[model samples]
Target: MQGDSRAFEAVIKSTERLVGQIVGRMIGNAEDRKDIIQDIYLNTFKHLPGFRHAARLSTWIGHIAYNTCLNFLEKRRLILPGENFLPEEEENAQASNAIESLIAHKQLTAILSEKLALLPPVYRTLIVLFHQEAMSYSEIGEITSLPEGTVKSYLFRARKQLKEHVLTAYKKDEL
Candidate 1:
């Protein structure tokens, strides 16, 4: 990635944040995020020459990352379930009040992520692209091969599903 120097660095600098955000939000494992990002750049470099003026270069890179993440998730579906999502060991160093708050926040985040993971990948993807990536409906549609209207519908449904899940989770906690 460093050999092409200026052009390559510029491409990475411009696109890396979105790639990281996409990969981080979509992929569950922190360890795998780095590898997936490296793979995206590698694929980008390999496919760069064939890239016609089809769409925005950033969108192209995002498509690559998005597809790669989906493939990664598909391949690891079985192994993922057995994985433990324990909170990090760093919590021990904090004060008791801070530790309690941290645990509560972590529990909420975990529940949300679990609920997010339950959505069909397409729905989850639209949510991530629209909300996390802040992409336009047309752009998300281009990446997903769906029409803009379809993208809007899916995003709406996905949000509704998440809302239901969050409320259900809180209700269960109350009981």
Candidate 2:
């Protein structure tokens, strides 16, 4: 965003959907997600001067989004319960089928989120920078101050963890 408030507003408007999705997935409550989104915008505006334009603007904003969500959850003393943040509805057979589908998606997402959280902050940040934000390994190394080899290793480990979790979950479902 430029120094202009209108420009910043435009950026927020354009990115709110993405920001909301990230925040919603992390926090899982509509009101809390909105609060977290506002916090992210405020943090972005506050830290705008420190932004060196070394990364894509979206990547920069995404970094802010991730941190904001984490901080909010931390402040609220929340634990990342291993449940998919599916919409609440009554339990009927059709609803059960829908819930299963939603839970399957949520389970995968939750497992990845939990595994990523288990990683050290540096590894987690790099994994998100590379996978979630689609940054190049070199770019992640630059952003994270890690070697490219380290970035690759961390990504490999993270992906392996995700694979194991998903496979185990699938097997449990099958039984």
Top model by TM-score, which number? 1
lDDT for 133 (candidate 1) = 76
* Candidate 2 lDDT score relative to the true structure: 0.62
TM-score of each: 0.71, 0.55
lDDT tens readout by residue for model 1, 1-175: 3356578779999999878767876776778888999999988888888888699988888889888987898787722211532122232222223323333655765667778876665667778788877899999877766789878987776776665655555546556
| Candidate 2 ranges with C-alpha deviation above 4 Å | 1-3, 13-25, 73-132, 141-150
Summed backbone clashes in each candidate are 0, 0
Cα deviation of 105, candidate 2, in Å: 14
lDDT of 1: 0.72
lDDT by residue for model 2 over 78-113, one digit each (tens)?
653222222223334432233345446556566677
Given candidate 1, what's the lDDT at residue 56?
A: 97
